[model samples]
Every structure is written in C-alpha cells, then in structure tokens.
Target: MQDPTATARPRKIIHIDMDAFYASVEQRDDPALRGRPVVVAWRGERSVVCAASYEARRFGVRSAMPAVRAERLCPQAVFVPPDFVRYKAVSRQVREIFLRHTELVEPLSLDEAYLDVTAPRSDLPTATAIAEAIRAQIRGETALTASAGVAPNKFLAKIASDWRKPDGLFVLRPHRVEAFLTPLPVERIPGVGKVMLSKLHAVGIRSVGELRQWPREELERLFGSFGGSLYRRARGIDERPVEPDQPVQSISSEDTFARDLPLHALDEAIARLAGKTWQATRRTERIGRTVVLKLKTAQFRTLTRSLTPDRPPASEEELRAIALALRDRVDLPADTLYRLVGVGVSGFRDREEAMTQPPLFE
Candidate 1:
C-alpha cells in the first residue's frame, strides 16, 4: 500500500508568541521598566512568578518559581501585578491581526496562538510573509515584540517559535525538517520532562536521531501510548490541525495561598475554587463527569484526585461536595501541606448526550 500520510497536503502553520508577555506589556507601558529585569507576580511567600522579562531570565528567574526564590535570584527585578483586563484588550488586538489573515486561529493563551495560513485571505505570497506581517502588526499595534515560527505543522512551528528569543522569527521548511531535528535534544520535543528525559537517556536515546533509531513497536513497549507518539514526532509527523474553536474540555480555578495549609485546612479553599469553576462551567453546553481536585505540595510536587460520578454535578453545591470528597482520595500523609489548591471538572459530554437518560436519583 502507498503511504497514506503522503497523500495529504502539508499544512502551513504559524505559531506566534509574545515575548515575556506580562512583563513585556508592563515594560512597554512604562518607560522606567524598559530594559530592566521585570518580574510579573504577586509578592508573597507562596506566590509564583507568572512571567519574567528576558533580563530577569538571565538571572535564572522563570515562571512558576516561587516569588521568594525569584526575588532572591533577581533582587533588582521589578515586580508588577498582572492586569488581566489590559492583557485581554491587547490579546483582542492580537486576535484581530490573526483574523485579518485567516479565521483558523487557535489561541493557546493570552500570549500565544497557532494560526493556519494555508488559505489566507491576505495578499501575502507565502506563509513566511504572513508570519512577518503578523509579527510586525503586533509590534505596531501592541507596542510589544513577538516571535513567530512558520512551519508545516503545529509541533514544529511551536518549537521553531522559541528557537529565537525575544523578537525573533524562524521557519521550518518541509525539505529542512529532518536535518533540523536530527541533532537536536529529545527534550526539545514536547512532553519530555525530567522523568521522561532520564528514561530516554537510560536507553541511550538522547537526540531525535537516536529516538528515530528505535522501532515503533519497541518504543511502544517501553513507554506505552506516549512511545508511539514519540516515534512519529521524532520523524516530524504531526497531524493535529489548528482548530479555531477547540472544544473546551474543562473549566477550573485555582488559588495559591500566602502560606501552605494542611489537607484538612483546605476545605474553604476548595469550596471557593469549586464555586468559581462551577460558574465557569455554566457557560458551556457540555456537562463534565469527573470532578478533580489539584493540590501542589510545599515541595512543588503536584497531585490530583478525581471522581467521576454516575451523574454530572447538577448544582454548585453538588460540585463543591464532589470536589471536597476528592480530597479523601489523596493518599498523602495527614500532615502534608499544600501551597496551592484547584477544583475542576472534565470528561465532558454534550448536554444532550449527558441528559439522554434520567439520573438514578431522579
């Protein structure tokens, strides 16, 4: 049989990411913050850095690092509180730019998005030109710099977008994908975190070239379902499309406290976040079966417990109860303290499908 994948036309995708988004926006609005180490975060013992300017990054500051640690790392860094309203306004402007080219824009966050320019509405001659136009438009409109990656697929495009630091652009042509990925570290591929990296290293697979050396079946035997994905990703194969309105799988809200709280003391926090998440879920037409409780220990380790009831939560009280009950599932010691807590629901199904049959209690 002929190669099935080769029959499909290669997609023209672009990944656009703002540079140090929150920090960069602060720097742009305030002349005093420009060219300085800016750290956007809430200052507290438990708070984590949300964004770090390139200057702060040089001092080893990064997002998700504790604010106290970030301060210690970059003592001179200016800390700024996030202004989501302003960020949303700027994000809207960025989206408008994308819509000018193509409606196939999938926003990953307020600061980054994937765009399918395979069939753009603009007069641009090529995908690279479209990327340049988008980047230039963002700089002009938002007064901030953006990096762009033009590639044949989303995975390569995302990696390419980060190839250059603040205010850079890179392209991954179909003809050059193999050579470009061969010598690069396997960690460069998404989902290869520390544990995965260690596992790959133990097998003497350190680079994309080394990963590609393994037979797909053997890799699957080693890492389960993920191994199959790795086999394909190593060869620069990704079939995911840039969906404009990707289905919302879950809605969640989380809070990081000023101090770590023991498991028993988390009831109030869980209740509060459950309310927030419940309100968010009301906007969707889907009902979720799984209620998840997420906790981050003082040591930065994360643990999640989920329960899928026979029926979806029908009320805020029910959502809160499910979230609270999930705490019972955490096998950690009673003394374990968590610095953060979140409540969410997933395993979504359409309202029609979810309500096709009456509840057991009803």
Candidate 2:
C-alpha cells in the first residue's frame, strides 16, 4: 500500500475574511458613519457586541463583550443593530465571487470562508494572485473590504488571514512555514485556550519553539488527544482539507438576563428560547433528534443537558416540552442563580434518513 500524503501535491488554500463584517456594512450604507467608531449591537444591558470596527477596537471594544461595557470603552461609538437580511445578501455576492475561481469553497460563517484553489478555474498565476483578485472583487462589488490568507492548508490559511486586518493579504509559502510558526505563542494555536495555556506554562512551554521540544508521547500523556494535535501544530503540520458545504450540525438560541434568576425562574426563559430555536430549525430541511438545555451560573460556570428522543421533535410544542424537561436533569443546587439560558437542537439527519429509521416499536 502506498502512503497517500507522500505522493500528494501541495495544496493551495485561501482563507477570506470580511473585515468587521456587520459593522462595515453599517458604515458602507451610511456615509456619515465611515470614519468614526462603529459597534454593531443592540443597546441593552444584556446585549453583546456583534462586531466592532477598527476605530472601536482602538478603544478596546470587541465582539461578544457586553454592550454596556462597549459603551464605556467608546462613548462616541455609533451603535447599529444587526441586519442579517442585508448581510446575507452581501454574503451571497461574495460566495458568487468564490465560485468564479473554485468549486471547493467552505464557508465558516457569513463573513469568512476557505477556498481550495489548488486547481483553480481562474487564470490567476498563483494562489496569492487568486486571493488578491477575490479581495479586489469584494471591494469593487460590495463597497466593503476583506482580508485574505494564502497557504498550503486550512489551519495556516486561517491564521494568516488574520495576520493583517481590515484589508490585507498574507501568503505563507511552504518553505517559510517553520520559521513563521516557531516563535509564535502556543495560544496562537486554535485549540489552545486559557486552561491549555496554563498547563503549557506550568511545563515551561510558552512558544511553538518550546512546545516542539516535548516528545509526542509526553504531550499525549499530559493532554490526551489534544496533546497529539499540539504536537502536529507546533511543527506546522496541518493536512486537513477544506470541505465544502459542511452540513449545519446544530441551531440554538440563547439569552442573558439583566438579573440572575434562580433555577425555578428559568421555565419561561427556556420555553421562549426553545420556540426561537425551533423556528430557526424550520428553515433547514434536516430534522434534529437531540434537545439541549444550557445554563450559565452567576459565577459564569456553564452546564448543559441534552436528550435525544426516540423520534425527532415533530412540532414547536414538542421541542419546547423536551427543552423544559432537560432542565430537570441539571444537578446544580436549588439556590444556584443562573445568568444565561440556551436551547438548541442537534443530531440532524436528512428527512429521508430520519423517516427511514425503524420506529421504536414498529
């Protein structure tokens, strides 16, 4: 048997990301908001920032931060509520531009995507050139900006896309991959969160260079499956392909309350969230079998309970009932106060696949 990777050709992948997508669209449509700070979010105590323009970022505003905090960071920032209908229209335009170059386009979200242009349909001489063309087209057609990263694989491409912000392109040539990654902090790796960082620090591993010194066996012993991943990433060895049209794995709706509520007070919120999630799920053709209930305590600790029914939820009322029932499985103290609640549906299958499954008692 032959080794597949050994004979495989180097891939040319490009990651494209719209710069401050939601905020930029707001600025683009309204000329008066162009030069100033723009924060896209609802103005509410519980609202969170959806996107912040470069101007707002300079004031320390960031996406997902509470809206109230964002206001404190940039008092003069213009806040605009998100208009997903408009954003989706612009996203479709960007997707059309990607299809002009390659068929292997994987959209990560409304504002970012990965394109495998190893064998592009366009006559661009290099992957870098393709990225440039795409960026130019986005700017020309949408009156907005995008950043691009050209690399041999998805991981590097994603990292490189963010290397230069707003409107820039970075190409990571194969020859320079090692030198580029060597000095990077371990936290730069996608999965290295705060917990992982503390673990790496305790072991005196700070940079990719430091992490590279550890043997895979030791790393794996310390970190389990993730340790194996850290080992590969430290050496710039990512071979994952850009899979196009990845199916929607889940849909959810969540809310944060202005005041923390005891467990018993979550019933109304859970039902409301379940209704929102059910409506969102209706837009998809697949059916979901699992109902998930999530809660965040006042201390910010998160917990989730999920149930997969014998049959997928057949109506909004069924979804709401299952979501409410999942709350019963939460083992937190009765007095525990929760600041957030979420309802979600997952375990999706095509309508035919779901219908074909034998009934629990046929």
- Candidate number with greatest lDDT: 2
Give TM-scores for every candidate, taking all chains together and pairing residue i with residue i.
0.94, 0.93
- Residue 313 lDDT in model 2? 89
* lDDT value, candidate 2, whole model: 0.90
User: Per-residue lDDT for 32-83 in model 1, tens only?
Assistant: 9999999999898877899999999999999989899999998999999988
Over 308-330, each residue of candidate 2 has an lDDT whose tens digit, in order, gives 87788899999999888888889
Clashes of each: 0, 0
**Model 1 vs. true fold: TM:** 0.94
Count: clashes, candidate 2: 0
lDDT of each: 0.90, 0.90
| The best candidate in terms of TM-score | 1
Quote the positional error of residue 169 for candidate 1 in Å.
Answer: 1.5
Off by over 4 Å in 2: 1-7, 352-362
